[model samples]
Target: MAEFKIVLSDRETGRSYKIDATGPAAGALIGRRIGEEIEGGVLGFAGYRIRITGASDRTGIPARRDLPGPARRRLLLSRGVGFHPVREGERRRKSVRGNEISADIVQVNAVVTQRGSKPLDEYFNRPEAAAE
Candidate 1:
């Protein structure tokens, strides 16, 4: 199951709460201090939901997935054949450095991790799915 981050803050006392994303209702019960009114609970920077409540018992939370973005892209780029600028007048091009790197990763994983074949498109004519 996916995890979410949650942040709770009291409007009256300025107290704050940070917790891993779970059922908001459950966390609200866990994170709220006794007799305190819940003001807000929201998702934290990594996209986990925050829940504010009136009870307090902050403690261990589970690990969360951190999706790779620009910094990771750069690190990945550096480890393989580098990316190239998209030149004007070019309609299409070779696999991106990331793509190249991914292919390499697939090859390596297949060998070392004993994973199965990385699925490749059997045909290019299929329509792309809209972003959900």
Candidate 2:
């Protein structure tokens, strides 16, 4: 089984979490969107949901091709010329040893959208019930 390290950050709270995934589904998260939701079983639980915010390879290169112009420029400048310049909406691909390597260690940045085996509504029977 191929293992992957997923680093998720809450966009609102700025809190981050590290999760380890081992399976084929984990590998399928490579090119997902920022707000896309994934099953928590990929992390461990069965009923939970994880929302992806950002993703990158192990080396820190982002998997998404929609970075802003300034951010893209900054990344390119920092990584030097070895990395090919990519336009907006264009993914970077490289060939090595007769194989195409896009990303080896995919670092998935996400947020826990849901948790536990029960529905979120079950936790709160009424609006007043959440006040306590």
Cα-based TM-score, every candidate: 0.19, 0.47
Q: How many clashing pairs in candidate 2?
A: 0
Cα deviation in Å at residue 51, candidate 2? 0.9
- Model 2 scores a TM of 0.47
Instruction: State the local distance difference test value for candidate 1.
Output: 0.25
Per-residue accuracy of model 1 over 1-132 as CA lDDT, tens digit each? 223333444343344434454455334333232222332222222322222121111222111112121112312222212333466443422222121111112111000111113211111122341221
- The candidate that achieves the highest TM-score relative to the unseen native structure: 2
lDDT of each: 0.25, 0.51
Model 2 ranges with Cα > 4 A deviation: 9-15, 28-31, 65-102, 117-132
**Residue range 31-130, candidate 2, lDDT tens digits:** 4455668786665557878786555545555544344221222332323222555565454443211011123545666777776665333333546535
Identify the runs in model 1 with alpha carbons over 4 angstroms from their true place: 23-132
How far does residue 8 in candidate 2 sit from its true spot (Å)?
3.3
Taking every candidate in turn, the Cα RMSD to the unseen true structure, in Å, is 22.5, 9.8
